[model samples]
Target: MPWLATAVTTVGLLSTGAAHADTFVPLPGGEISRTLGDGTVVTVRLVGESATISPSMGATPVHRNAWVSGRAEVQVAGGIKKGSIQPGYVVGCQVDIAGGGVDGGASGKTDWEGNASGGLTSGGNLSLGPGEATSFVILDRESANDYGDESHSSANSFKGSEASVTWADSTIGLSGCAGYAQARAFVKVKVQTETIRTVVTLWGQPFSLG
Candidate 1:
């Protein structure tokens, strides 16, 4: 929970900027539980979700900016021993994402290959036209690989029955979209037992970005 505490402190610092042209929106975080073929239960939850929307720095309708924060928690049962948690967001421009899930390859998880990277950059800066959407992991963790070279990953691996990841004031900047925009959060957890592996995803409620 040390990371969570750090995130809390960051949130406090970020929230102080609310005096500007920022619109604070509270999100109704969600939870989902899935049972694997081997009867292993995996549960994922998104909590303390929120967004602070700000006017475009460019002073144009085609630009938007937001600061998002949330915590993703995972619980595994039925003798599951390990798993990985991937937390991300999907953003849409003049498109409906409230129904959950995006098509046309707009829905994808971050690869764990260390060197692999997602479509959106670590800063969450994106440019999309109308009816376009994209997904990106929020974490950009850096470490040394087996060869002692630099590596990056978006997911956190965990052992035992429970694990959680917290993020605060993550930026989401969009441009080149003339219409309304929206975004939603997702937490994907992959749980593995000695003989079985399963993945469960939890989606948060979509909210307007404009």
Candidate 2:
């Protein structure tokens, strides 16, 4: 369905941190905000052109549609939260949209209607160790079915694991594994309401290549 472009604006502070240190941009009194709570809307003004939109979480690039008539309110965050803007958030960027609705190679795909604008924060991560297998379940609280969505699991032990994520409006999931040495296996995941999807990461010594 097509949506009407809703303009919004707010005041906020835009800070930039260094890779090895903490930095600040001080986006004070700029008429642009990046921390709009749930249900809060804001507007954004593009300079004679539209900008790319996508969750700034990790490496996940989920795309969506949003039009910034003048500005947009920062609504949701991926996982971390601090005031309106998280520790790693940019102002004037709340909703997550594809770059000009063109082929910007966004992580996730979505539909659009009015001008597309917004920001995104990516959540959910998966990792596997050598000769390791795992499983994951997906759930949606807004649905009657406890398993509102599909589940995923890793069958064969693998030397590594690969992660692939997909999302709709507010729903996201992932699949794929790495280093499976031709082993037979089956994995299952269940989605239910009140799903507390946490990030799974494996930490260990680096593998050497001969």
Over 4 Å off, model 1: 1-20, 101-121
RMSD of 2: 20.8
lDDT of 1 by residue, 1-210 (tens): 222211321332232345545888999999898888888888888999999888777779999888899999887777866677877788899998877546311233345321344443445688989998887777667888899987766667877778888898888889999999999998877787889876777889999888
Candidate 2: tens digits of C-alpha lDDT, residues 126-205: 33233332222111112222567532111111111111111122211222222221110011111111223211111111
Model 2, residue 71: displacement in angstroms? Answer: 9.4
- Cα misplacement distance, residue 159 of candidate 1 (Å): 0.7
- For candidate 1, the 10 contiguous residues with the lowest summed lDDT are 1-10
TM-score of each: 0.85, 0.17
